[model samples]
Target: MNRFLLVILFLFFALGAFAMGQKAVVNLDEYLLSNTKSGYTNVMVEDMVFSWKLQGQDIFVKIFAPLEGWLAIGFDPAEKMKGADYIIGIISNGAPMINEHYGDNPYGHKSIVLLGGKDLTGNKEGLENKDGTMIGFSIPQDPQDNFHKKLLPGSTHKVILAYGADKNMKARHAKRYIIEIKL
Candidate 1:
């Protein structure tokens, strides 16, 4: 009886451990596909597709552009590219990298880290295929940074989307678009 009880207790603990290990992991493809199907606002500019959704206090964004270079989105530019916050995504050696940037001038931007700001992005994902490159990430609606504009739901804001010709970020964008989106 004692041995049987011990075996039963062990089995119960094993089952509990197994359940604890079953955490959900979301990959880049899953994130884009799931959100696309679940009411993400999608806009097509030329050959690029920009999708965004606001969940709770954070906004998730996905950009798909037909280029092998860096893709970027700028929020609430004061004029041209000035006074805006930017998120740039690149795939290097099959790994995804996301960078936060602040628009320093009408034609240029610098990394947020260089300007003494933190990277307030999460859940970054990227994929490069024969068709195009797709990148996704999430950021808080109010990042509380001087460089970043406050993004509010139900408000319309101007956004800039661009992509380079190659993986070099310093190179000029091959194509650019400016449009207004309602969050």
Candidate 2:
């Protein structure tokens, strides 16, 4: 099908889902193509096109990227991808996993801890595609210290994007991309 048709269909289902309590993950490809005149700057890194929107004192973050292995988005870390607050996701054994990690320097304190949700990794909510998977979650404007730092509005935060991080051992993100944004 044509891209336009795909996006229209996506919006249809997504709107229905939103009516139910859960919001939908906006596909990166479709969003970029449709919103050519958007106010937000384009944030496409590697195979991932980051999409974000503000709603009710919360910021919704989504990563639509092909998962050859895994993809991650880190917030305010000590280094590029070190000692950061991360939302890491992957398909492990046919099961989709979105994990919340607290990054510690020297790669020794990487812990899979809770990020203020019942599930450590903000619920597994997103869409999957042949090109890649769209893994998404949300963070409050003002988060607790467990998330490493407070994310207040009008403040800028630096995030590192990485693909193919080793899941078994301490996460070492490859093909890392770093960028800063203001909420």
Candidate 3:
């Protein structure tokens, strides 16, 4: 039984069976997108920006790495807000279907826009890359959710970071975290 102690007891049970089939961190924070969106009461997921135009100077940014918390913008006459939040829902092509509590006067709705708010748990602030590596958010960008602007000029927007209020979430995309913008 001494072949180097049987390969060190089979590499200690194969690294304890790969750490018990991994997946812990509370099921990866219950599959991100801020725990399935809606009017985040106070979950505080500060920033996430994904701008567009690469071969042309306007390549705006933000998004450093698996960030899943900090967002506290406001307005909810019934769009409601509470814990377990993070909701962005915009769908505009032919306009008129704005829901975040009466949709304001934003008029046209450009390809789904709904970035959530409320969750400043003691003001921590994490994601920030500064000069280009993305991850930056000092808020401000909701001019009535960026008023449509020809359904978003130079477009290619299809973002989803959910949980806020679920709404079936279309099979939930395992919690939805896809921010790819090319405006």
Candidate 3: where are CA atoms >4 Å away? Answer: 1-4, 27-75, 78-183
Kindly list the per-residue Cα lDDT of model 1 for residues 47-70, writing each as its tens digit: 788899898889988888886789
| Alpha-carbon RMSD to native, per candidate | 9.4, 10.0, 14.9
Pick the winner on lDDT between candidates 2 and 3. Answer: 2
Query: What TM-score, over all chains together, does every model reach?
Result: 0.80, 0.66, 0.25
User: Over 4 Å off in model 2, which ranges?
Assistant: 1-28, 31-42, 92-95, 112-123, 165-171
lDDT of each: 0.85, 0.64, 0.29
Per-residue CA lDDT of model 2 for 85-116, tens digit only, reads 77777766556677777765545335454334
**Candidate 3, which ten residues in sequence have the lowest lDDT sum?**
128-137
Model 2 pairs whose backbones collide: 66-132, 83-103
Backbone clashes in model 1, listed as residue pairs: none
Model 3 per-residue lDDT tens digits across residues 1-183: 889999999999999999887633422233234423421211223333332222222221222223232211222211222211122222123121112222232221111224342222111122211111112222222233332222233554434333222222222222224343434
Off by over 4 Å in 1: 1-34
TM-score of 3: 0.25
